[model samples]
Each structure stands twice: as structure tokens, then as C-alpha cells.
Target: MSYPTISFSGGSIDRADYIRTDPAKLEELKDWRARLVKLDGLDPVLTPQNELEWGSLADCPPGADLVFLGLRDGRACFAAVPEAGDAGALQMGSRARAAMGILGHDDLGIYGMARSLVDWHARHRFCAQCGAPTQLAKGGWQRDCGACKAQHFPRVDPVTIMLVEHGGNLLLGRQPRFPAGFYSALAGFVEPGETIEGAVAREVLEEAGVTVRDVSYVASQPWPFPSQLMVGCHAFANETELTVDRTELEDARWFSRAEVVDALTGAQGAAFTPPPPQAIAHQLLKWWLQR
Candidate 1:
């Protein structure tokens, strides 16, 4: 069976670091050949063909900071980040969430990166250490603080999302925010200094009361909701018993392999709805079923 593309991960863009660092090269690329990704604030404006709508640099508003997204099709690409006073331009992610249902793979990846970087710039306008305003540098790749001489780069948080199995059954959970009957893999952010395996085991045990072992890596996705790296993993638990943490999960239970197959295949009578195809959790379920 063919698998769906993982959203917002596999981008085919060459981020020309050399161009970003060199003043002359970066300046030269800002000509008519350069493409600008149109954005309504931080949200994407998609073409009717479900692709990213490209515009010329002339289209960008004067005084807008242009971030170098990289080279696409051998042409320099960019996204315009508005000045800080234009708070009305920032959508605060509602539009980007809506764009998810419409974006194709490449556009999804590009927009994901654009939205995250733009959002970061909006939020991190000041130096964390010195509480001083920062300036954009290196084509929006870095923010520099003159007061403390500090440099800040974009951050991507690591989260471990895992499928825990015992006796041919897979464990799934639902949080309060999830729609009714929708269940997905248990996941949590990896604490600082924690290993991937440790995060997987700890999240499962804490949320579902399942002490899972035999942690193994499967795949990963760049979830750009404020920039997170989702580390997909699988682990097996010896016990089928669960101790659901009410604060962490609304519910947690094991489903048989057959039920999981029905969920992934979109057949009726699934015990719970699987995550959408673009989600890494959905891919993990498919991977587990195939294995």
C-alpha cells in the first residue's frame, strides 16, 4: 500500500548559508528573479492549484524584513516578515491551521518553515538575557543583541511520540481537546538531557501507566506548530494494565490489531478514529500494522 506524505518535513529547498552570510551575494539575489512567498502576516496564501503562490520581491511592502527561505528551482526564495508595530499582520496561527487541509507536501513544508520562523521573530523581539531589543541578522536566520552582544537562533523542541504495544494490542489515548472518539499515540516533550528512549518510556508510563520497554526509532516529522521535532518510536510493554492519568489524558486504552487496521483503513466500526494521514501518529499506526 502506498503511504501518504508526512506533512511539513521533507522540503526540497537549498538554504544557501553562504548567501546569507555574505552581504554582496545576499544583496545580488534580491533582484527580479527572486521569489517571495506571499503571507498574510504569518499565515500562507495558497494558489488555487494548492501550491505556494510566489511573488516578486517588488511585491513585498517597503520596510518589511525579508527572510531568506533558500533556493528553490535555482532561484533565491524568501518570506517577508512585517515590522513589529504591524501586529495586525500576525494571524497568531489560526489561518495556518486552516491551511493544513489544503496544502500539498512541498508547500506545506515551505509554509511550515516560514510560519515558525516568522512567529519566532514576532515573539523573540527582545534579548532574553539582557531584556534589550534585538536586530535581525544573517537574513533573518539570527537575531543579535547589541546590549549584551548575544545571538539567538530559531529553536526546535524535541518531542517523542510513541506507540506502545502489549500482546498484539496497541495503546492509544485521547486528551480533552481531542474530538470525541478520536484517539492517537501518546506523546510528550523530551526533557532537557533526556534520551529518546527515556522520553518514550517516561511519557507512556506517566500518561497511560504502561511501563514500555524495547524502544526503537521509526521515523520523525518536523511539526512546525511553533517548531517542534516529533521523534516517532515504538515500544512494547509486558503488561496490558493501564493507569490513566486524568490530568494528562482523558482516556487511555488498548486496541487489538484488527481494530487498528480498521481505523487506518477507514472502515466503519473502528473503536476510535485514527489521527489524520498527515500526522506522524497516523504514520506510526500504519507502520506498526505493516510490521
Candidate 2:
């Protein structure tokens, strides 16, 4: 029996496709009269900490913006924003710090969007068209420069994470900063002008010196640590010989199914376990094992 890549089950909610393109929904969200509220943690709905009590398209503060991510249940789903300084402060608080490990996908999505938008606003305070400060427009979806009339939108970065398997063993590696015995799948930011498959192959070869074939998409997760979407994949190894790049990996090896099972079950003497359930890496490994 071979070790399997884990799969995400609980957090895998199929966001319906209709939310993005429907004109009515978009119009409703874009309406100036719509009500938008911010929540601290999972509180139902609380007023925003800023002075802009009501949602508006024209007066969002610098370093404050929203990422309009379509609709959830016909109500516009958005990543709300506050000041970047405030975000950092929140992270330093005991509650926020504790939530980092406990937050689910939805919570992480919100946090990511909020933080990234704030960062974007911080950097884009001045318009690209004319070096003048821009104003938030369209419910925080776009920013407009008052001087030259330029608009900017939020961005999402794509990253690839893959589980590589050959024969009955799955490949895993530990980073220099990782705790002893800790290992996860190889991952890297997807370079510009490269497909997901290309990124996976490239990352595998570069980090583990392993040749891969039959690359297959597994799943994707929104990792908002700073606005990244993790594209999970599984690739069959064409060559099993290990030659880890010391600069990237402190250690690398193949783990059998039984070994992985023991680690997951916390049996004595097992190596470090995967990340918490909130992480896609854990899901990927769980999915692989069940299959």
C-alpha cells in the first residue's frame, strides 16, 4: 500500500458560479444604498471601527479598501478592510494570535482579503496615472485617482503545493525553519507566464531533484496569510532517487503508508505530523490516505 495525499472535505464548499456574472447581484452590491457591516472575529455584525459609518464608493480612507469576491447567498460577499496598522495591532492581541490556529477557511479568507487590501491601499495611496492620492470607489472594489482618473483593483497571488509519490512512498521535506521532524509537501509561488503543471514540475525538480509525470489537480484553498490561493496537486514520480537541495530543504525522504498512518494517529516514535486541519497540506495528506 502507498501513502496518499490528503484531501480537503470540510472546508471544501462549492461557491456557486451564479454569484459572479449575474447582473442583478452585481448591481445590488454596487448600489450606494446597500448596507455593509464589519465583524470582529465571528460576531454576527458590528459597525466598522472607522468613521465612514455607512458604505460608500467615494470616501474610503487610504489603506482601507474591500475586495469584492462576488456574492454569497445573493448578498455581496466582500473582504472588508481597516487600517493596516490596526491589522497588525489585532494580530498582536491575545485573541487574534490565538485565532490564527483555530480559524477556518471562511475566517482565513476574510482575514487575507482584509489584510491584502489594506496593504494594497497602503502602497497605492497615490494613483499610477498621476502621482495623486486615489479614492476608494465601487464599494471598495476599485480605487480612482482624483487627478488623472485611474482605477485599480485588488490582486490575488497563485501558489502551487504538491504531494509527490513514487512506488509505495510519498515524498516529504522539512524547511530550515521547521521544527525537528516536521515535513510537508513541496510548494512554491507560481512564476508569471507559467501554468500550474509547469510550476509543480519545476518546484519538484528544483527542491527535491525528483522527476515527475502524470501531474493531476487535487484541490485549491484560499490562504490569506497575505492573499494567496494554494493550488494543490498530486504528481507521480518518474524517478525515485533523492537529491534534496540543501539550500531549500533541511531533509527529504519517502514515507510509507504505515508510517504516515502512525504519525496521523500519534503513535509513539512517529515523526512530526502534518499541519492542523485548517491547512490544505493536512487535507491533501488525509485525502491521499483515504484513497
Candidate 3:
């Protein structure tokens, strides 16, 4: 079996730690450098600006600031920047979203970090314990509620995306929202109280009515579309018969390795193409095909 090579490099670091540190130095630097982003009427968020002129400014609200999970040398680094506007839609003004779709490997790294952390801050404005709003504390690493005195941290939802193979063929499915004739691996969110292996088994069964065995962990990616960490896996299919759940998938079937190769290379037909390489699903398929 020959699988395509995923763009993952061994030296890449997961920058989670640095982003959680004290941003006092970062803030001081920003004070001098004037980091800012200007929103244009709020329909779609405007593009992000990394640097701007720091004018006479008021004190930032306790929790009102931008936090970035920077990856240096492939490890996670957490840092906070001044939150200018709604962190969730801050990139709406930028072309980053559309760029990721068209530019695969190169675009995935930075854009993924920016979008996810910003979204995390957006949804975590208020403390879950008490109704009192929280303030950004610990350099944007935490939120502290003034009323209840509770601490809140950023969260990442785990999802399992698998490539199920049986008898030299891989199972693929298409959701209604996907482009016409586009098909990819079966995936779903990991349910509460379930393990990654359990989630992979359950999602394949639920979405495609296929039973899987010999589940193996492959790789993982940070999909920051609202803060999700996608765990990629390869599962051995016990049964090839696919009973598609129409509610979840428009169609489901098994494709030969050769056919998948053609589809991926755009040799079989122009209509069929996997998702951009930034997506774990696409990377999973690429890995499987190269095997």
C-alpha cells in the first residue's frame, strides 16, 4: 500500500504553554509597538493587523485582550495580545479563512492557531459558575469571575477522524453540505465519557453503519474552528457493508486504493477531490494512500 505524505514535520512543536504565560512583557511591547486591529462595520470581521500605532489608550478591561497559541519549533507557546474586538469574529475581516481552503500545507499552521485561540476567548467571556462576567487574568490564560471568584480556562473539543479500510479498499462518505461528488473519511466529535478508540468505533457505526476493529492512532491536528483537536486514526473494518444514515451522510461506499489515488490526484475525474491538506481528514487519507 502506498500512501501520500502528510506535511507534518518532526521538529514542529505544540505551542500551548507559551500562550498561557504572563503577557506583561507582551503588553509592554504592544504599548510601545501599538498592536491593533480595526473592525469595519462588523458584517464580516475585518482582517487582523499584527501591529498598529498605540495612541493614548484607556486601561483594558480585566479580561478584554487577545491570546495567541504560538507554535515555535513545533511546540505550543501561549501568549496574550490586546483583544481589540470580538475575538471570535476578529478574522472575519481577514482573508485567512478562504486562504486556508485554497492554500493547504503552508497556511494551516498560523491560521489554525489564530482562529482557535481567538474563538476560545470569545465564548469564554463569562464565568460558568456565577453569572458575573469574568476578567481576563493570568495573561489571557484564565478568566476570573468577580462575583463568584471562579477560574475558567480555555478548552479544546476532541474529535476523531478515521480512515476505515477493508480488503484493500477504504470507506468514504459525503455529507449534504460537501461539494458535489466530494467524499472523505468518516468523522465525528468524541462524546462525553468516551475514549478516542470508543469514539472512532461509535462514529463509524453511527454514520456509515460499519463495524470497525483494530483501531490505531495515527496523528493529531489542531482544528481551531471554534477550538477542536482532531485525532486521526486508522481502523480495520470488520464488515464492508455500508448502511448510510441519510440524516448524517448523503452517500457512503468503499473505494479501491487505486480509485482513491486517482481521485486525489485529479486523474480519475475533476469532480472528485479531497478536502484541502490542512484538514486532518484529508491528511489521514493521504497517509493511508501512501501506505
Candidate 4:
């Protein structure tokens, strides 16, 4: 079966380590044809025209916390933190939301990497081992504590988002925060010591009170809204009746194949809608539709 190209999933960049331990390698940064990705807090700095806003290392303002992301087509790629107050022609907003609209597929992939790394750098400024301030190391892929000599790396939280099916219907649910009339595949963070299949089954039972079996992996996407690896799956529901936990979901229901097709295509007269194409849930639903 053919799969749609997921956003933020393709790039041919190589994360070179020549600059990782060698501070000297950073000096040649200005000599390369590099792409710059700037972040302010959790958002990326965008041009007035709404592009990713790339510039030279020399153009970065003073006090920009910079990290070499790697090589794109043999050219250096870097991410920098433009001093908050000096963001002259750039503006900041939700990276997750902005990425989908402003970036191309490959650029979106690079943005995801940058977003996750910068978030780690910002959040881990202080070391947990000895309570000392940590400094960037290994070309921004790691942090080193000066006090106790501990190192920290960026973390990717694993989340299970599964489409549960039984008979000729698929299961979907809605949370209060979701837009009106929209429903999505059930999802939750994978807990410690749990397998992906185990997590999928557990989450399905917990949220909708539907026991699931034959869990199968479908695909994964690097969701960089503060760093999550969404592990998409397809599962078979053992029963159809739902006992939705109100605290977890507002509603959970099974939709037949025809109903799902209408929702996926945004057909008029549809009672509910699936998530957008940018989300993994929408991909899962699309996969189901093709089947």
C-alpha cells in the first residue's frame, strides 16, 4: 500500500560531529553556505514575508546562543537564539502551528530538529547532578555540567496514537479542547517499561473502555511540539460498546467506513471531522480509508 508523505519526515541532512568537541571548528562557520534557523523562546523567528528567515553567522546579533545542527547538502546548517529584544524584522509564534504553514517539507524537518534541540538547551540550562549551570557541548547535541562533570542530552517522549477498528467501523474520540465537531484517534504517552503494543492497548481501554488486540505499527512522526515521537498504530477492537472516561475524553464512538470517508474529505452534512493532514491521526484515518 502507498502512504502519503508526512510533513516534517523527510530530509537528507547529515548531523556532522566535526564541530561537536572542537570549538575551533566553529570559527569557520561563516565560511560555509549555511542555513540559519532562529528561535525565540519556543517559536521560530520568521521573516516579514513569513519565511524561515535564514542569514549568515556573522549577521546573528551579539549574545545569540548558537548550535550547529549539521550539514545540508554538504553545507553547514545551524540554529541560533537571537537575543530576545533585538528581533528586528523577525516575529515569534507557535513553532508547531507556524511550521505547517510556512515551511516546506524538508525545511519543516530541519525545524523540528532545531525546535527539539533548542527546547532542551533552554530547559537544561542548569545541571541536575550538582545544581551548576550547564554549557552547550558536542555541537549542541549535549550539555556538560562544570561542577560534577555530568552530561545531558535532548529527550524525545514516545506517544502512542492508534486507530482502533472492529467489524467495518473505526474508533475516534474528542476532547473538550478540540475544535467543534472534530474527533481524532486515541492517543497517550507511553509509560515506563511498556511496549508500544502494550501502551496502545492500555490507552484504548483506559480512554474508551474498549479492549484492543492485534496491535500493529503503522508509522511514526517526529512531533516537535516540545518533542514527542508519535508512534502510530492500527489495532482491532475486541468490543464495540464504549465506556468513555469523562476525565479523559469528552466522547468516543465508532464510525463506519462511509462516515469516515465523509469526515476525511470534509463532505457537507457530515456530523464530525477528522484531524488535518498535518497530524498523524489524520494519516491513520487516511490509511484506514485506503484499506
Candidate 5:
């Protein structure tokens, strides 16, 4: 029996790290039936057919940087950047969320990987150590500096997003940038020395002025708007009333389970709405409501 994976988490792809380093395998990669994802200025190109859009290795521009992504259905998958001189009507499109309806979950996840990696490479063209130009190595997974022989890999920031509960009520807050009448579980970035539990409690108290305990993990998601891992959790608030920190949140309040249920189900007289299913916050809310 197969268990359900998190949204935007699972793909039927093997990363093939061992094969990525093999010269013979690299030659074979150029011949396999492959799916090519190209980023034209951070947007993925999609075919009119509404599929992920594949291209032939022979069609790839000469001397283009190709990164072996993985093997999908026993076929190779690669990510590349279009050449400035190549002439093709590459239809530029929005990121995954904007085009979620047409894209598969695995496609979205793979797109996230490609976007994160390509963006990282663009940002770290030079070595942090020795200030030397770095070359792409390990099939776009690693960068090497000839000056210092230093190697750098892509970095992923971790953020903790947790829903706080007290008694039968759930605590949620909204930032000024959020849409009106929309709120989500409070979240903050995990500091270098802080644990996930510590970040959860700290964020709750800092944002809502509510102390929390009994922190527990719910799930995690790969948020690739520049590469972040969202750590989802549930915590029990010791207080019911909220002292909203105006700087962090526009307002915060506790909502009864009935109110949340109404909001989630789009019942009449609903006052607020949570995030969409594409986000881990939505999954956390569903888990909490089901319990």
C-alpha cells in the first residue's frame, strides 16, 4: 500500500547522483528520452499542449549548460537555460502557483527544483572564498573555484510555520501584505542556533503574545520562491486572548472551530479564509480540523 505524499513533494524521479558523476553515464544522458525544463528569465516555458514541455537533446543549443535533474519513468530529465542567441519562440510563463491548475504535482516539484538551482547558480557565479570565478560541476549540483579549490552547493533556508491552539480555539494572524480577511498560521525563520520547537514558540509569542507548549511536527514543504523549506507544526497556546504585535501582524484573534469549519467549507457568514492547498499551511489547517 502506498501512502499519500505531501503536495509539491513527491515525484516519480530518481536523482541519479551516482550516474551524474560518471563520464560514460553523462554521454548516455545525452541520448536518453528526456524531459527538458528551461528557465527563460526565471519563468518556465510550457507548450501549448499544457504539458511540462519536452525538447530533444539535439535541439539544445551548442555549449548550453545542462544539468541532469533525474530519471522520470526510467528516462532522463534535464534542466537548462536558453541561449541568448538561440531562436525559438520560447513561450515564457509564470511560476508554479500561477499556473498550478494545468501543471502536475510532480511537474511543479520539478519546476521548483529547476528554478531554485538556476537561481542559485546565477547568484553565486563567483566564489565566496578567494573571490574567484566558479565553474559549474557535478551536473549543476556543485560549484568549484579554481583559485581556492573551494566547493559550494545550493543553500536552502528553513522556516517554521505553526498553528497555535488554546482550548477549542485556533490562533491565526495576518501580515499587512496579506489579502483582507485572510490569515495564516504564524511563521518565522529558524535561526542558526534555534531548534524548530524553539522557533515555533518564539514566533507565536512574538507575533500574538501568546505562550505555547506541546509543539509537534505536522509536515514540511519545499517552498522554492528562492528556496526555502517550510517546517509545519502545531502548538498549544497557554492563553486565549491575544496581544497582537502591530509590527509583526496587522491583527490577531482566536477563532472557534465552527468558524474555521465555516471558512474552510465556504459556508454562509464566513469571516476569514486560510491559504490555498498549494501551501503547507493549508495542510496543517486540514490536519487540525480533522483532529
Candidate 6:
């Protein structure tokens, strides 16, 4: 099936690797014409119209670390890492979800990049190798440790999120922190040296004690809650029996396609609240239904 336009996947900006690698090119873009994506500490700053707000470098306080967020329509873009000692927004998670809901797919993609890079720089201020302070390099793409000559870069952890299907029904589960009656596809981080398919199988078995096979890739999304690549997939459950791990999920059950349709469409008396549109879990369910 042709993939849908997943959230955080369709930015029009050109990530100028050339400028990042070349000091001269990077410097040229730091002029007044360059634009900056404003941030409230670690959170995004939106306009009154719910659009991504832009500012000039003049708005950035002196000595703030500016991360180059590539070129938007040939104009350089940047985001300032929140200054040190600034407290994080108390409602950061909810505010970010609200932004994702109102933002266009392209704008969401841009915010994803900016948030991840800015947060990475803020957290990685020191070299892991030598415990020495590091300096921004490669237009904020890399951190250089002068003491040990070590290089650090932003990382995106990969997570496998799958919809397990069997006998024309879809398997779904709810976590403890999720809203009451809310359920979504099961997901877990892909451990080191594990293939995507292998991870899917392993996660399904561990979380719900259901062995899955025929694991196949679907669409993917960039989830920038600290930078993660959500790998969506479809897998076939060999058996319907479930041994739910209570620690990971409050409950696990197989739901008919009709129930899923009701949950997704918000029909009255739906079985459970479906995952939000911005979530890869929601996309996975849509893909399964479309197929």
C-alpha cells in the first residue's frame, strides 16, 4: 500500500550538509537574513495563528548556543538551545502534544528537527570520553572535545511499533500512564544488534506473550521526544492466547475490525480511545485498516 503522509515526516527544508561541513559557508548564513525558530526553554514557541514562530538572531540572548537548522527556501534557519539554568516548562509534554495537533505536517517536521538538535546540545555539554567540556562544531551538528579530541553527534534511537493481527482481529494494549480506556499499538526500543523484524517479534512476545511472524515494514515517523525513529510494522500472531505482562501493560486484548473502526472514528460506545493522529500507533492502525 502507498504510505500516507505520516506526521513529522514531510518538511520542505533542505538540510544543508555542505554548510555544516564548511566553516565559511556556515558563517555566511549567520547574517540578519537568517531566521530562528523560537523556543520557550525546551518547548516550542508558536504564533497566535498556531504556526511555528520565527525570529532573528538578535532575539537570541548573547552567548546563547545557536543550532543551525538548515535552510528554509534558501534562507538559513536556526534554533537557540535554551540557556543553562533555565527551568524546563512544567507542562512541556501536554503543550508539545497540542502543538503537534495544530501544526501542519511540514511544520511539525521542522519542529521535530529543531527540538531534537537543541535538546541534544543541552544534554551533551561535556565529553563522555574525557569528562571535559565540549564545544559546538559542524554548525551545531557535532560537539568537539578539545581535551580528548572526541566527537559527539545527535542520536536517534529506533523503536519498533507494530500492530499484531490474527484471524482478522488486531491486538492492542493500554499502558498504566495512558488515559482511562485509551489503547494503542505495542512498541519497544530496538535493542543493540537486533534487526527491526527481530525486535518486533521479541517485543510482541515479551509484552503480551504472543509470538508473531511475517513481520513487514510499514511507514515510519520521526518522534522527537528526545529523538526517536518510530519504525511501524505489521505482524501476524501465530496464536491468539495472551499472557499480558502487567508491568508493561494494564491489559491486552484482541479487538474486531468493527471495534477499531468505532474507536478511530470516535463513534459512541467505542471500545477504547484510539491513539492520537500524531502518534505512529495511530498511523499503524490506519495502515492496517487501509490494507
Highest lDDT model number: 6
Off by over 4 Å in 1: 1-4, 83-94
Regions of candidate 5 where Cα sits further than 4 Å from its true position: 1-5, 58-63, 81-95
lDDT of 3 at 288: 83
Q: 1-291 in candidate 3: lDDT tens per residue?
A: 544444322223344454446466445534433322221222112234332111222322344464534444432233333344244521233454454444335334544555455556666777788678887765556778999899887777888989999999999899997878888888899998999999999999999888899999988876555567778899999988888999999999888887878877878464367776656788787788767
What lDDT tens digits, residue by residue, belong to model 6 across residues 154-184? 9889999999999999999999978999999
TM-score of each: 0.93, 0.71, 0.76, 0.90, 0.89, 0.96
Q: What C-alpha lDDT do the candidate models reach, one value each? A: 0.85, 0.66, 0.64, 0.80, 0.78, 0.88
What lDDT does candidate 1 reach at residue 62?
92
TM-score for candidate 3, residues paired by index: 0.76
Per-residue lDDT for 251 in model 2?
87
Error of 2 at 137 (Å): 2.1
* Weakest 10 consecutive residues of candidate 6 by summed lDDT: 83-92
How many steric overlaps does candidate 5 have? Answer: 0
What lDDT score goes with residue 74 in model 4? 70
For candidate 1, give the lDDT of residue 198.
93
Give per-residue CA lDDT, model 5, range 187-284, as digits (tens): 98999899999999888888888899999988898876767888999999887878889998998988889988888888877979888777788778
Clashing pairs in 4: none
lDDT of 1 by residue, 84-155 (tens): 422443123667777887888878888888877876787788999999999888988999999999999988
Model 6 lDDT on a 0 to 1 scale: 0.88
Candidates 3 and 6, the one with greater lDDT: 6
Instruction: Report the candidate with higher TM-score, 1 versus 4.
Output: 1
lDDT of 5 at 98: 69
- Whose TM-score is greatest here? 6
